[model samples]
Target: MSGAAAAAPVRRLAVIGCGLMGGSFARALRARGLLQQAVGVARSAEARARAVALGVVDEATDDPAAAARGADVVLLAVPVAATEATLRALAPALADDALLMDVGSTKADVVAAARAALDAARLARFVPAHPIAGKEKAGVEHACAELYRGAQVIVTPLPETAADAQRRAQALWEAVGARVRTMTPQAHDAALAAVSHLPHLLAFAAVHALAQQPDGARFLELAGPGFRDFTRIAASDPDVWRDILHANAAEVRAQAAAFRAALDAFEAALAEPARLRLLIDEASRVRRAWAPAGAPPSP
Candidate 1:
């Protein structure tokens, strides 16, 4: 933990985006008495007002730079597509010693954004992070202090990252009851593409396929627990998913190709009952042996 993490409260924290991820982070830090002030940036007037009303922030504004002024720490929680723009807008307003972090799902792209927007000093203080936490519900209205409790948070440090910034970022997540891990940006992106991105793509496509059928509505109406469980991620915010899928398009596409090959194998084995049964049995074994870790399946 950094001195600031265990000593006096951090001076101020700026939450950019002020949506579910950003709001929950601010709420958790406030609940833990880790920060003195919370300022939020959002384009929607209603969202800004709601953030203040929900105690997600002490004040809110639409200007990203204004929100970042005097902030000792800043959490960039915007969608991946907006990361560079948000960082560019706030870079000049950040304090000399401010520690910057993010909750973006993709790390490689975010690191690239930071490099493009931040100067040498600001870039050194930037520690790209991804918290494997959230709910099906969206918006600041659903934000709560417990959203990150027992969750997994991954931080990818750049080659020039400052020591204090790294310490402060980890301590902040720890204060909020999250388990933190370290990974290179590229490694983080590749792994998440396989497990997280691939699964989400499959979910969305599966639901889309079903909906395209002639009796789509009736089929959905009669869907059982199995179908509902498999398609749950399809309920994720479409705009958010669109940005994510596009941002990591290459990896997602590769994973999709891999899935197609697996499907082809299954189809080819259909004529041989013994081979089909063996394939199913192998899959069942993998699932049975697997156990999710504390929060993010050991990621």
Candidate 2:
């Protein structure tokens, strides 16, 4: 209410967590005139204050239930580990017909948690989602309204999820400039484990391994652009990554094994000078012929 302007319509949106992803969603809603009023919920008083001060939400509270009490759309944006607890806290407050969605990186775990926490009627309105775009940075200060632009957003709905709820969730993401896609919770987890989770793990491992060297600090200081780009995700929130890794352990492990195999093959090629030259030439040709100028080749 404090941040509401004279003519601004209020859509009564509630965002749990108010971190980078949550704050960005709220900001996007307001920027596009999609929400009449937005409220933010976070555990810390400082975060609540920051959200309100930044105008990401008209009101902010530390109580999840209080924020979700009458929200038309509730977005759970907490870390994967905390998502279940947050959903549990808000379950009683969520309206039976209100749309409930999440931006958690993993889908299956969140879907299971929502099933366990919400009542049958409330569960029907839940739509589990993951926005496939983010920065290595964390916190509300890093959130931007345009963060979701041109990004893929996967919406995973169980059989119990209402068709209307799923449609609304997809519409909301599309409204925010995202390309909404549908998948089962299992498929979503498996795909993300390969493209997203595994890459993060590799990046983290690479950085950690490099840091263990005697000249690690000096090496990092002298690192080039390729190293910087490859390792950028290593700076992502540790707690969040830890939860994602554990949530999709099986798929992540499989992807990791595949990556290890590829690395071994590369190493073998390096041991043979002729093969090494062939490898470089083949890689260069394929990369030049197929790769997009600024984007990775789509799978």
Candidate 3:
């Protein structure tokens, strides 16, 4: 929704989490020669080592602040729950002109974290971003340079965000081969709750419901492609999803209420043949007409 002039290569890039999202970003930018140096920080020494060993980043460290120090750009790619603590650690070390952004799944909570953790100047440098791209499998080992190619990235700039930071945020994502869409933090959370968060919740719940059955194992043995496709996201990292679901709990709850109402309508329609056909037809039309951004339409 917003546009910025192209940014030249940066001096340094620092990533706080150095996991799937963070490592992938580093790889993407490195492929483009966008930074003179790229550093990564993570709690797991093994992961940090893997990042450097895989050349996802030029260097690695355990201290987030140490990695952030002197960096021209910083990406907080940790879990949404760890956002505040990570920001607190990095803020003191962040250079005044440096731009900071996050790859968080949710924006409202991350914006709240930024407000609580950073001073006015530091907050001004912070840009909240969510790249709508990932694989079901997550880890530094799975990081790829092409992961964000053609994906849509949501940029939610706060009122306090500096013009330079916003511009850089837009440029950074575009450089990584992602299309950018700007949204207010509240709007981002509300809309994502209905489309993304609610679907993940349903996938997780459906799998749990299936596994809880006495014939769960037997049922699984006979499962087909439809079951596999529907529950694929249930295989997502539990801890990561837990943090996301909790961080956006209020929005997710509101969306869930709407989902229940939809379910109620479906149930009522099931009792009437004509109404059932109408409901199915409407849903089919909507689904067939829609496709993920950058995706080819269904045949």
Cα shift from native, residue 168, model 2 (Å): 0.9
211, model 2: CA deviation in Å? 1.2
lDDT for model 1, please: 0.87
Ranking by lDDT: 3, 1, 2
lDDT of 2 by residue, 46-80 (tens): 98888889888888999989999989899999888
Better of 2 and 3 by TM-score: 3
Q: lDDT score of model 3?
A: 0.88
**True-structure lDDT of candidate 2:** 0.85
- Cα displacement (Å) at residue 273, model 1: 2.6
TM-score for each of the candidates: 0.94, 0.91, 0.95
Supply candidate 3's per-residue lDDT for 57.
88
Candidate structures ordered by TM-score, highest first: 3, 1, 2
Candidate 3 ranges beyond 4 A from true positions:
1-5, 295-299
**Tens digits of per-residue lDDT for model 3 on 1-299?**
12213757878999889889988988888787776899999788888888899988889999988999999999999889999999998889999888999998999999999999999988999989999888788889999887887788999999999998898888888887889899998899898888888999999999999899999989999999989888888889887889899989999999999989989999998889999899889999998888898732322
